[model samples]
Target: MTDKETYQRFIDWFRRTWWDLPESVHLHPMIETYLTPEEVDLLTNIPHSSQGIEEIARTKGMAPETLEPRLRALANRGMIYESSREGSVRYRLNDSFFAMLRAALWPGRTDEATKNSAPHINRYFLDGWMDQYAEVHLKGLRALPIDRTIEDKREIMPHEDVVHVVDDKKYFCVTTCPCRHRHNLDPDMPDCPHPTEVCLHFDELAHYIVNNGLGREITREETRDILKKAADSGLVHGVSNWKDGVDTICNCCSCCCMWFESFHKLGHSASMDASNYRIQVRPETCKACALCVKRCPVDALQLRVSPQARNKFGKAAVLDPDRCIGCGVCSHKCPSQSLRLVPKDQAELTEPPRDPREYMKHYLADRKAAAAKNQNTAD
Candidate 1:
C-alpha cells in the first residue's frame, strides 16, 4: 500500500480504537481552526517520530498556521512532545499518552503493532507518560517505609481492617522496586527489567480486599513484608491505603523512579510490570543486627544459625528467592549493603512469554463470552 493509504488505515484503526471525538463546541477559535477531524486523524496516524512541523504539515497538505497551534494543544494535553534540534522544532507522540490510547483502543490486547511489547507493561507505560502533577501528588505523603532500618513495631491490618495514622508531619513515599518509571532522567529507564511493576496493582487490590470486605486488618510490618515478597518475586511495588491513614510505601527501581526527574521522561501510571527477580544477601556482610530479618516484609528473610567456621557473622540472614520480589529495599538498608537485586536471567525479561496478539485474542474471547453471559442474565 502507498504511504498515504497505510496512514489512512492507521487513522481508521485509531478512531475505532480510542473512540476519541472532537469537541462539539470549540472553546478557543484558534484551537478549533487547527483541530479538524482530519488533523486529529493525521496526528494519530503519524508514527512516533521526531518530525518537524513543516515536514508534518507538508505531508498532510496543511498550512503551518493550521498545524502549529493544534500540535501545541495536544502537547499541552500530554498527548505529544515538542522537541528541538539545531533550532528546528519537531513533534512526537508522548509514549504514555499513546500507550493509553492503544490500551483503550485495544482492550485486552497484549500487543500493538507500534508499541514495544515488553513483559513489564506498567513500567513501559509510566516511563513514557509520567508527569509532574503525579510527582507532587505522591511527594505530599507522610510515613513511608523506613529504608535500611529495622523496627520492632511493624504492624499489619487484618484483610478488611485499615489503620489510620495521622502524623503532624508528612513524609515522601519512595521505593526501590523496579515498577517506578524514571521519566526525568538523562536516559529513560526501560520498563521493569523484571516483572516487579505489576505488583503495585495487586497491592492496591489487597487494600481493595479490605474495602470490599475481603480480610481484616494488616499491620505495617505485614504490609512491608508483602511488598518485599512481591518485589523479590519481581512483582510490582505497593503500599497500604494512605488517605485512610496507612503509611505510604512505593515500588521503585533505580533505573525508572519518578523521583529521578532530571533523567529521561518515564511515563507515569498506576500500573507496574510483572515481577521476575528475587533478592539475595551475602551472609558475611550481614551483621547479627537482624535488621534485614526483621524488616523483611514477606518473611522471605530468615535468621539462620551459623556454623562456627562459617560464622563470619554470629548469625546470617537467608533469602528465599521464590518468595522474593526484588524491590531492593533490603539493599537500601543493609548496613553493609549486602542485599542485592538480582534478575532471573534465565527467565525472559524483554520478551513476552506469549505473543501479544495471542494474548489479546484470548482476552477478546473472554470479554465476548462475559458480555454474552451478561446479556443472557439481562434477558
Candidate 2:
C-alpha cells in the first residue's frame, strides 16, 4: 500500500473500532488531530492483542534494532499498551477510547502536540463525538455516590462505598481528568475551576496508567482524599459499569464532565445504567431550604406546600422519581435532613456489565433488538 493508503487504512480501522455510530458521520478529521500520519502507520503495525518484541519489530519494514526505539516512543505516548514480565516485552493497542484522548492531552513529555491539538480535538469531541456517542447504547460509564456523602446513617452497599472499593484493591493510581484538561485549553473561554487530578484507576488498570506514563501511583489514603475533595467541590462521582473491572473513579463536575452534562443537560436518553438508588424526601422534615433543589444535578428536587406540615411556614422539598438518578448530591447537603436514598423498583435495577468491552456488547444488543421490534410493529 502507498503511504496515503496506509494512513487511510488506519483511519478506516479506527472508525470501525472507535466511531461505531451510524455510518453517516465522518470522524477522520477529528481523529487525525490525535494520530498523525507517522503515528497511524505505527498503529497499523501493532496487533489489537498484546505481543512481544519480535512481532512488533517485524512491522513497518524494520528489524528489532530499528523498531524497538519506535515501539518505546509509541508506548511512552500512550498510543499503545505494553506489559513487561520475566524479561519479555509485549505490545498492543488495547485502549483506544478516552485512553488515547488522555494520552494526547497530558502535558508530560511530548505534550506540545497534545497541547496544540487539544482545542480542535475538544471542539469536535465535546460537540460532535458526544452527539454520536449519545445516539448509541454506550454504557461505558455510570454514576456512583461518594459513600460518606450518602450519610453514615444510610444503608451502604458494597458497590456504594467508593473508599471501600479502593481499599479492596491492591493497586491504584490517579490521573489528571481529561475533561478538565480539555476545558482549560482556551483562554478565550472561561475554564472550569473544579479539581483536575481526581480521576482514579485501580488494579491492572492502575498499573496500566502508571506504567504507560499517563498517571501516578496513589495510596488508599490519597484516593480517599481525592474523593473527599471532589465531594467538597460538588463534583459527581462515577465508575465504569463492570463489578470486577471497576478500574476508575471519575470525579465529575456538571460544567465540563460528559457523565454529568451529557446526561443531565444534553438529555442523553440512549444511555443505560444509572446509580442503583434514587432520592426520597420526608416532607415533615423538609424545611423547604432548597439545598437539595440547588445541588441536584438533574433538577429532580422541587419545593411545594405540604398539607401535613400545616403552617410549617413555607413549602417542602418533594421528590420527582422520574428525574432523580440517585447521585446523593442533594442528600449530602440537606440541612433539614429530608432527602435520603432508596432502592429503585426491582424491575428498574441495573445489572452491571461484564467489563467495559462487554458493556457495548450488551447495551448495543439490547438497543438493536428494541429497534428491530419497533420496526416490525410499524410495518
The TM-scores, one per candidate, come to: 0.33, 0.85
The residue-level lDDT of candidate 1 at 224 comes to 51
For model 1 the local lDDT of residue 257 reads 37
Q: For model 1, state the Cα shift of residue 37 in Å.
A: 8.8
Each prediction's RMSD to truth = 19.4, 3.5
Q: Model-by-model lDDT, in order?
A: 0.41, 0.69
Which has the greatest lDDT?
Answer: 2
The numbered model that scores best in TM-score is 2
Candidate 1 lDDT by residue in tens digits, 176-270: 23223222211333444532322222233233323322233454455456555544543223333233433334444434433333123443322
Give the clashing residue pairs of candidate 2, or none.
none
Backbone N/Cα/C clashes per model = 69, 0
Where does model 2 exceed 4 Å of error? Answer: 1-7, 18-29, 85-87, 106-110, 126-128, 135-138, 149-156, 187-189, 264-266, 270-272, 308-313, 364-379
Report the lDDT tens digits of candidate 2 across residue range 156-241: 56666676677788888888887677767745446888888888888876786787678899898888889888877777787777
How far does residue 172 in candidate 2 sit from its true spot (Å)?
1.3
| Model 2 lDDT, full chain set | 0.69
